[model samples]
Each structure stands twice: as structure tokens, then as C-alpha cells.
Target: MSIMSGFCQISPAGLCVYSNEQTSSITGYSSEEMLGMGWVKAIHPEDRHRVVAKWKKCNANRDTLGTSFRLLRKDGEVVWVIGQIAPFLAEDHRVLGYIATLSDVTGRKKAEKALQLSAERFSKAFNASPSMMAIYRLADDRFVDANNSLLEAAGYSRAEFVGRTVTDLPFWVEEKTRNSITGLLQGKEAVHNLEGRFLTKTGEVRIGLVSAEVIELNSEPCMFVAINDITEQKRAEAAIEVERRRLFTVLHNLPANIALVEQDYSVRFANNYFCESFGESSGKYCYEALYGRKTPCEACRIDKIFQERVSCKWEQVHNGRPYQLYGYPIHDIDGTPLALTMSIDISELKQLKEEMLRLDRLNLIGEMAAGIGHEIRNPMTTVRGFLQFLGAKKACAGYKDFFDLMIEELDRANAIITEYLSLAKNKNIELKEQNLNFIVKSLFPIIQADAMLADKYVALVLGDIPALPLDEKEIRQLILNLARNGLEAMVPGGTLTIRTYNDADKVVLEVQDKGQGIAPDALKKLGTPFFTTKDKGTGLGLAVCYSIATRHKAKIEVKTDSGGSIFVVQFQRKSPVAPQMN
Candidate 1:
């Protein structure tokens, strides 16, 4: 007997009388030990009674019987086996003993059990999954199985779905979709995310992404398809895309520079102003692209915003003009941090603020001067007259020089008071259609005389200009004060040039002096009362000039550099409706 199968002989009592080596190996019992031993003892307890009953039945009938049962080995292991028992008979056909054979089916049994387990798992998973799934018989393309998700999504009962073909249900809204999927299955190809429209039992069309693969079901080729319903997702995505485009349009046209920056200091998006100011910066570091720097700027605030998770505002000067920058922290839907940075030019705004403050100070000083001018000067006048009257007497003749100096000092004080009063916002002014060149010429002699005394040369350049409303007296004072300041700013032999010209709808008078440029700090405070740049200067000259210019609706603009400084007063060519008065 082959060792793969166990063989044994049993007597009428069903006790093993002889056995092959295979039987000893299969039962882990030697032939001598198994002799006279009941063969039923080797059968597992759970299968013993049934197997013994069958063995006795076969012996009584004197026929062969086959059965499968578990055997308990001496090693304490259970082995499955299928065995055949043949009854040995005498000439009268009376059963005497039996011959038995057994083949081990343990490996095949384990394999079958594993297959059953896998099928059970697949069924549970297929039914429990939320994804819509269906199996179709490849031979006829008929639905063999469908999960609950598919039945609910398609509005179909299991009875209505299982036996129907794709065409019978008319499921796919497009014929091409059906043909394509069928073709893929026939060609042994898997379909992945083939988007198509399909109809429900209610005739409603729904969008779905179909993915399928060929699988074996019940020993026959079948198509297993999984569909993902994306109708709402697609619609939401479309709406989000539309909103994104609308926001892009709004930002792109904004007047200020706007940019979206990532944590890596890279520019994610830039508006028109940003792109035009810094060139194309997408996918590049912000500092390197916007400012042409190899590293981040020392004063950069963007990094601080990211690290601290806050917004910020600051002012900076770019190319000699003031700019205000604002930073706001933002996050994406996934919670990625980003920054929205905006920069706006504030040069004109800053200048306007400064001008307002300066005018406020001038008005305050002017009011003080107008309120107390005569009251203070009257006593000084009376003292001067008494001093002169006393000096002419013989008793006070020795103090005549002192008396003259006192009277001169008083006159200087009175002159300062007059200049201060001129700064009053409502100071009276006579406005007439007058030629600026004529006024400049009339004052040229006095300006030249003063320049000569200061050992400075003076030159005049007059251009053809339209006549403008002017207060000749105040115009003369404005010219003299500016010319004297110019003459004082230079050393001996330095030249001062005064010029008048026409500048589109306005008349311009410019005083040019070859002096070192004014310092930036001092330049800002130029028009405020008592704000002086000179050691012996009263500082009211320029203040009064600004006031006079305001009364005439003119603008004072200054341009200065290391080479020289120029003070320009431009008068609008329109006449005032009436002379201004206080």
C-alpha cells in the first residue's frame, strides 16, 4: 500500500488485526500495538459514533461504504480523512472481516475552509460599504448582485435589479457609456473613473464616476463596478470657482499693491499694481523679487506676522516717497497660514497733514500778535519819546549814544511785531490784476542793495508770464524776505538769482541761492512760527510769506539738493473775487 493512504484489516469484532506502515504513521500507533485494538478508538470522539454505525452497516450488508471523518492522532492532532471499507465475505457471502483504506484530506479541507471564509468576508464588505457597487454577469451583461447603496441610489428593489440586463433597465443615460464599459470588460481591461450620466428608476439623471474590474463569481467571468456619486461635489466646485474668479477680478483692478504670501516668503499671487511695481513675482521669494535683495530686509515685518500670528501696519520710505503698508494674517481651508500684504502711497496725504498743522500754528501766532501788538508797542513808544526828550537836556546829554541805541532796539522790536501781524489768517490784502514781473522789477533795486551790503551778487531772469491777482505791498515784502534769506545763506561772492516765468495757468517766481541743501529735518518745520534755521533769524519771514501766498491762492514749492536750493511761489492766474480782509 502507498504511504499516502493508510490500509488496515479488521476482524468481525471491528478490531484491527493487521496494518501497513502507512496506517501506523497515520494513526501514530504501531501495527503490533494496534492489533486487536478497536479501530473505532482511532476515530475522533465527535465522529466515532456515526463512523462506527456506518462500518457495522457495511459489514452486515457485505458491501463497500465510503465516508469522511476526523481522526485523533497519538500526537494530539486532528486529521481529516476519507475512507472506504470493504467487507470480506466467504463463499456463502457471509461477512467475516473488513479491509479499510484512508486518504488524508487535511490540506484540501483547510483550503476549502479558507475559501469559504474569504467569500463571507467579501459579502459582508460589499454589502456594508457606502459606495454603490454591482456585479454583472459577463456572458449576458445581466445584474447578478447589487449592494444596498446601489438599490437606494438608483431607486430599485433587489428583485427588480438582480435579473435585469443593462438594456432592460435602460440605466445609462448615454448609449456610448454602456458600449464603452462593455467593451472594456470584454477586452479584459479595467475601467477607472469613467464619468458618465445614468438614470434612476424615477427617470432622474445623476452624475457618477464609474470604476470597474473583472472578477470571477461562481466560476464565471463577471464585471464588478463601483460608482461614486459626485453630482453635488461638482456643483459646489463650480460655484467656488466662480467666486474665486470674482474675487480675483476685484483685487486685480485695485489701485494699491496687493499680494498673497506664503510662509516661505514666496509670492503666491500678485495684483496688477504689485506686478507692475515689482515685476513678475510668482513662485519667487518676496524680498528677492520685490526689492532685489539677496536676503530679507532688516525692517521686514512679514516674517514677524507669520511667527507671531498677527496683523501689522507700518510706514516706510521707498524711492524718497512715503508709503504705508498693512499686513493681515489669513489661512486656507486646510489651515495653512498665509499673509495678505498691501502697500499704498501716502506722500501727498502726509504733506497735507503737515500743511494743516503749520497753518494752525500760524493762525494761533497771528491771533496773539493782533491781540497784543498796540498794547505792547505803545509803552515802548512812550519810553523812547521820553528818552529822546531827556537826552536833549544838558543834564542827560552824556547818555545820548545810549538813548539812540535804546530807540533803535525799540524800532527793531516794533518791526518784528509788524511781520508777526502779517501772518494773521484774515490779514487784509489788496488783490489787483498785476504783472509779477513788474513787481519783481520794482523790488530788484532794494534786493540788489541788500545783496551788495551782504557781499553777495544778485541776478534777475524774467520770462513772459500772464498777469495774476496780487497784493503789490505783500508781494514786495515776500520777494524782499526771500531774497534777503537767499543772500544770507551764501558766503561772500556767492550769487543769488531771482526769476519769474509762466507755468501753465499760473505765474511762478523762483529765488535761487547757491547754498548747501537744507537738512531734511529742518525742511519739514520751515513754515512754523519761531522755527528758524539761522542763529540770528526771527523765523517770521518765511511764515509771513506763506501767509501772503495763501491769501493770493498761490503755492510755495521748494526744491533743494547739495548744489543749491530754490524757493518757488506759483500764483494761479485767476483774480480773487474780492480783496481778503481781517
Candidate 2:
């Protein structure tokens, strides 16, 4: 009776009744051969028993039989079918044949299985979602079908929420939400997420950001909304704004020339006083802006600090007006150099610094020359007389050994003079951009060898180093001298630490030695030439370091006691590059 109807003729045993032509083609048998075959033989193997039982039940009752089962084709593959079989009778109501209607059920069965699997995957995704979410009805009201996060927060069972309107929830503030919805329905446009408030089940007010869009669910009108909690973020932003304004107000009252430079060192912000102090129309470089020139002036103290990774102080002529300046780099949150700068005009202080330097340099040179002159000259005169006497005499018994010892003393005197000259005289350092840390790393192995000879252990505690204009050769020499000193200071099996890093506004290099640390008096005399505390020692190493540091405008700081000696070199950034002479 269905629109999709077909008929079949079967015996009471449920087998296809075909004409002679069809029987031979389908069964690979002639009509006579099929007539003797059992109807169950043509039925699918798995369905054969069930089909046979249904046939017997229908025949005994003389009623219609309906069932869906699989039948075997001539090729032995199963084909799904739905069938209605009824008894065919003669006038005496005796069964003669069977009539049946059938339709293929294979496609329908496959589709039903596919639909079931799709539903299972959707269910899993909905339940396992981390975000608070749900399906909603657009026509009736904003109704939540399910939400695990909501259930946990609201303490509501699924049955309590499903088929229930969000408006009826007392915490939702129905009046406000309905007004917004009415506006959306009138416009028929999507509403972006906006901040709103909600009342919790326990009646506590909470903030939320929400947005909704029109959608089709099951071929009907609906809406899908996503909500997020942002109460803390809102509070933090307001507090930050208030603090920022307060700080800005105070910063505008600074007395010195301070400017906020961009990452590229360009003048992004300059105060009214800074503009009055240093005019505009300067080049991009910070030095060019302050000094009004393409190249840095000679004896650039700031440049030396940055270049040599040390501190320096000096006075320079800007347009013939000497400005005693001290400048250093600013560091950002991650300790990277920033373009921010603070400078003060110390022109009046220039005369005081020059006088101090002159007195200090003279006093240093005078004390050093006086202390060594007597001992050095006395020893040399004795060694010279012994050598002259030895040369005057012929080689006698033990004379050669005595002569050798005298010559060794002579060589020691000469070595002292050479070291003193190197220490006091300022050799051209050839300041250029260099990695101080690289110089340290490259010379570490040589330092280790020196330590081995001294029977001491060395430790390298390397830190951060930023690239700058420096002389690799000079820094290498400086590091070599310090490391050698560290080894000599340490007793047998003592440790040494060589560390490098940027210390705030300065590039810092420190050499720490665990040994019989220098005495306070010895430490004070460190930068004076020929002030050695060791036997057979030329005490010009630290003096030469001080000379090199001054020439490069770098600073040498010492921390020494019995525990150990730590020599820290700090360099200021924003110093100009020194020119190379051919």
C-alpha cells in the first residue's frame, strides 16, 4: 500500500517465484531444477533460520506475514529487504501459493547508523567543553538546553534548567536583558559582546562580557551566546589609569634636563627646559643632539665608559663652552638598554674637577717615583758593581754560578724600568666597538694555563654583555693582565672568578680571586706604579689597568680584603666612538 510497492510470489517456505526465463538466470538453474530445490537454500545464510520460522508462523495462521531480513543473491552476497507475505488460496480456501510485497531497506539502515554516530560526537563535545556554553531558543525566549559550567556554578541539575527560560532565572535581571533583546529583534542584526552584570545563585553580583548571534537550530529560529567573566581585568585597568596620571603629574616637575627618547634614540619627548637647554635641528644620534656635530669630540669620557665597559668622568668643550657631563645608559624591564637619558649641566664644576685630576695625578706620580727610586737604584747599583767586578775577574771556581746570579739581578732591574714606563705612559688604546665578554671568553683558556702554573683553580662566572664600540685588542690585554694578577694572588689550589655583565647603566666586568686578599694600604696603592707586595714582582699591572681605564674614560672599582679581591670595571653607554688613526 505504500508508494514504494512491489510484489513477489513465494511458496509457503518463502522463496522467490520467478518465471522460467528469470529462474534460469537468477538461480543458475532450469525451472525443473529450481522446483526441486529447498526455498531455504536461496535465503541468506544468517537470515535463513529466522525467515523459515516466520514462514511457518504465517502459514499456520493463514495470515499476512511482515518482516525485514536479508536474502542471498545468486552471487552469495546478502541484500536487505522488507516484505509482506500473504496466503494465496483457491475457492475452497486451500493454500496454493504465496503473494508478497518487498522494498530495499539497505540505504535506510546505513543512514540511521550514521545519524546515531553524529549525535554521540556532538554530545561528547557539548559535555566536555571548558567554556561556559549552551544551546538557546530564539523564538520563545533565551532558554538554556544544557551547561556543565553553569550547573557547577548555579548548583542546578540538568532537568531543572532544560526547557526553562533564562528570563525566569531571578539572577538574570529579566527587565534589562529583555529590553536589549527587543532592540536586537527590531534591528534583526547581530549584537557584539558587551559588558554586563549578573547575579549569582547566592545573590552576589558578578560582571560578564556577552555576545549573541542569530542561528538556525533544527530548521527553527534560535540564538547562540558566549559569555566570559572579566571582573578583575576591569578593576586593574581603572587602578592603573589612576596611578599613571599621578606619576605623569610629578614627572613634569623634574629640575634637570630629562628627555624620553624612542627605542632608536630619537627625541620622542623633550621637556620645555630640555628644548631650551638643547635646541632642535640636531642629527639623530644622541651625541649629535647635545654637541651639535657629526663626530664625537676628542677625550670623550662617556664614549669610553660604554666602549670599555667601565665608568668615566670628564669635561668636554661644546661650542667652546666646557660642560662637565656624566651620562649613562638606561635599562628597560628586561635589563636591555633603553634610550631614556638624564643629564645635568655641570659647567661650574669643571674647574673643580680639573684641579682635582691635576693634583691627584701629580701626587700619584710623585709618591710612586719616590718610593721605588731608593730601593730600585740601590739594588741596581749593587748589581752593576757585582757585574763589573765579575767581568773584571777571570772564571775561577764557583765564579760562573755567581756571575749568572748577578746577571739575573741585572735583568730584574731592567724589567722593572720597562714595567714602570708601560704603566705611567698612556699608549694609544685604539677605542672601537668590541664585545668585552668575547675578549674575556677568548682569553679564558690562556688564563687557565696561567692558573695551572700557579697551582691554583679558576672559575668563570660570565654574565650579560651588550655589543659596543671598543677595542678588542685593548680589552683582551686588560683581561689578560687581570687574570694573571688573579692567579698570582691566589695561593696553591685557590679559586678565581671572572664575571662580565651590564650593571644598570654600565657594562660591568669583574675579576674576583679567593686568596690572601690585598691589605687596605696595598689596595689604596693599587693604581700606583711599582707598588708590589710580592717578591720578584713588578707591581705595574694594576697601575697600567688604571691608566688604560682613564685613557678610555673607564672606571676601576676595587673591593679587597683578606677574603679576596674583586676588581669591577663599569662602562657608560651613549659615548661616541673614538676615531681610528691610519
Candidate 3:
């Protein structure tokens, strides 16, 4: 029926009699050569015997026969062909000649062989893949084929999976999952890494990542799926999350300010105390949040922590508060290096330590002074009486001036001994409750006169204060000494300020001077006996004041800067009444 076919007429003995134009084109032989010699001469040597046997059978039975074989062309090339022969019958029912039809089928044969090779390669790869693979018919949702991995993953045999639908097998943990997959396939949507739970034959539930695509198998639409197990990975992630939450809880309730900082000084995590002190510091530079500075602090120790891989500690003062900072290097699970810093407020602790040391020194000095004062007074009194008696003799008038000078020197020495006796351990004094404002009012006149003499101003900022149990004589001495010291530290036209107020549960008395501040070295030694900055003056003024404050159970705090200095004495609300020590 197609023009590609070739036709020829052959005798019963298999010689070519009549040939069409297509026969010459198909075999590369003209009718002149083929008709005389015979069409059997064109048969390939390899197929010649088989084709001749079929031809002889067709001739003997006069039945239609078809066969395929390779043909040798006029140019010695071999071609595959399909041929059919039928008997040409006469009126008497005897065969006249055979009618044969031939066609060139080489192109179709080559295409079929290529397809077979491709299918073999695909089968090998699918079975050898590590990931589970399956192919199911989309129409019936029945599994058509499954690889060894897929059978192993489900703990099933190949026979158990081949003809079964997903619903018939224990594959999906939920019925809704299968429905969702079907919906996606029907919509022609490819699924990628869709998570689903699966149940194996052993009743084990496993989490899997499934990917599916619609493909054609044997001219029928099918679904090809690949599954990867992710149960262990999911469990590991959950455990890490729990640990992270526990760490956060511990850091949140800690008393000190804690934070995690990166190499660029950026804060990665800040605990509750750190956030409360610095205010929402995450993603901000450490220096900017902690010190309100635009640049990093000059003494940052984060680099040292990284280099040494150990903890480092230092002290810093910020906004009139002291903090002890400790930093340690830490690496995250991903091995990224970071600094963990903890800052503790040590301002009050440090002040208390200094106060204790000062009190210990005062007590030690008082014991030594009391012992020496008594020994010097008796000898000084005898010398003063001898000098007076010598000045009174008329015969000694020429030496009277010398005797008077000697008496004056002896009196000066006796006065120093009396001052030292004030620091004795057993001196007796009475304690009485008195209003501090009344005492300040009484001292104002004397303090103002001294300030006026120096051409300085004195201000009395007295607030309402409670009555304090005090020895009025000792309290009076403490106030005057501090007030006169303030005046002396200032120049003419400078102001000396005295303030009294209640702070927390304590009563505060403050003395301020507007002048060049005390030298750093001198400030540390201010209350030490015989330590004075002024020449031609006794250094016992501040020492005696400190001793009075110690007897009253008060604390002396000093703050100095480039502008001036302030000395504050804090007394407890109720004083312990005991014998006052000199």
C-alpha cells in the first residue's frame, strides 16, 4: 500500500522474471541483471540458506509466506528487508509464478535496537541507586516497579510491592498524605523534598524527604518517586534546641551582666542583667552600649582572650561606678570564635574594704600615741617651772630674756603633749542625743569668721536631719577641723560649702572646697599622723578628725577631681553609746 515497497515476479524455480522500478532502487540491481540471473543471487550469504528453505516451502504449498533477512546489494552492502510471496494461480488451479513484495526496513530495525539499549541502561541505574526509587501507575495508583533500595527501606520484598497500591501497603503513616501526593500528581506539579512519615513492615515510623515527578512508562502516565530518610537528623536538631533554651535560662537569671561578643565587637547575645544595665544591646558595638562611647575602649581585652584562649580580668570605672570585667573565649557549635564577658559591680565592696583599712590604721596609731604622751608630760612640766623661776631672779636680769625664751619653748612642747593625750584609749566622754542642725548653727559663726578672715565665702546648706547620739565636744571638734581645712585649701574669693542631709538610712555631713584638688599621693596619706601638705603647720588636724569620726562609728568618704574635693562623713541612724576613745 506504500510507495516504499518493492514488487517482483518470480518463477516457481526462484528465478526473477519481472521486476518493478522500486525493486531496482531497493536492491541496487537493475531488472536487466536481476531477471536473467535470479533474485536469489541478491540474498546475503549468511541468510541465504534459511530464506531458500522458506521459499521452497512456499512454492510447494502455494501458500502465502513472509520472512525477514539481510540482502546483498549490487554494491556489496548488506540491508535488512521483509518480503512476502504468494502463488499466481491459473484457471486450471495450477501455480503459474510467484508474486513477491519487498520493503527496506533498516531504519525501523536500527531505531528498535537503540531503544532496547537505553532501557537496559536505565534499569541498571535505577536498581543501583542508593536512594529509594519507585514507579507507580498514575491512573490506578498501583506500583509498577520498585528498586532494591525502595524494597529495603520499607522492609518488604519485591513481590510484595509490585502489584500493590500505596493504600494496600503499610507505606504512609497517614491516609491524608497519600491523598495529598495524588493531588499534586493530578495537577502536574512536581514535589521536591516533601516531608512525610512512613511506616515500615517492622512497625517503625521514620521521617523521610520525598521527591516525585510525573513521567511516562510504556506509553502510560506514571509517578516516579525518590525518598531520603531524615529521622536521625531531625532528632539531633531537636536536642540542640533544648540545650539552647536551657543555656538561655541560666544566663537570664544570673546576677552579673553577661554577653556574647563577636570579633568586630558586636554583641550577639545579652542576658537580662546586661540588657537592663545597657538597654537592648544586641547588634550594637560593646563599647557603644557599655560606656556610651563612639569608639572601642582603649583597654579592651577581647583580643587577648582570643589569642590566649583563656579568661582575662580587669577593672573599669564608668559613670562613677566601678566594675570588674572578665572575658573568656568560646566557640560555637559551628566553631566560630566569640568572647563571653561578665561584668560585676564592685563599687560598694571596694569602698567598704578601704574604710576597714583606714579604721585599722587609726586604731593602731591611737594605741601608740597614748603610750608616748604620758611619758613626755611629766618632764615637760618640771622644765617649765625651772625656766619661770630663773626668769624671776633679779641677779639674773641679763639672762632674763634667755630664761623667758626657754619658758616659751617649754610651754609650746607641753601644748603638743596635751594634744597627743586626746588620742588616749581610755578618755571618758558622755553621749547625748542632739539635733545636727542645731550643732551646725552653733558652729556657723566661728566657721564664717574664719572664712571671712581668708576672704572666702561659706555656705550652710542644712537639710532636716534626725537627732544623733553624739559626744557634743568631740562632734564640735570634728566639724571645726573639717571646716577650717576646707577654708585653708581654697584661695581668696573661693567658696567653702557645708551641707547636711539624710542619705538612705544614714546621716551625711559634707564639706566641699573650690580650689586645686589634693595631690593624688597626698590624698592616700591624708589621715596618717604627722602627714601634712602645709609647711609651718602641725599635720595632726585630719588625723584628729578621722579619730573623732571613728569614735562616733561613722565612715569618711573622699571624692576628688581636677576642680575640687568633697569629704563626707556618714553616721548610722542610731549610734552605739560607749566610752569615747581619744
Specify the poorest-scoring 10-residue window by lDDT in model 3: 418-427
Can you write out model 2's per-residue Cα lDDT over 448-521, one digit (the tens) per residue? 88888878887877776777667676677678788888888777989889987877778888999887778866
Tell me the tens digit of each residue's lDDT in model 3 across 1-582.
677889999886778888888889989988887786676788898898998898778777877879988888989888889998888999986888888899998888788879888889989999999888899998888999999987998899999889999778888898777777778878889888889899988999998898899999999999898888888888987787788779878988999999999888999889999999889999999999988889889888987887888899998887868999999999765577999999999988886776567657766767776888778877878888888887788888889889888888878777666655555445666789898888888999999999999899999999999999899888888899899988988989999999999998899999999979989888878787678888855777787787777778788888888888999999999755699899
Clashing pairs in 3: 423-582
- TM-score against native, each model: 0.72, 0.43, 0.63
Backbone atom clashes (below 3 Å) for every candidate: 0, 15, 1
Best by lDDT: 1
lDDT of each: 0.88, 0.66, 0.85
Candidate 1: pairs in clash: none
lDDT score for residue 229 of model 2: 63
TM-score of decoy 3: 0.63
lDDT-based ranking, best first?
A: 1, 3, 2
- Order of all candidates by TM-score, from best down to worst? 1, 3, 2
Candidate number of the best TM-score: 1
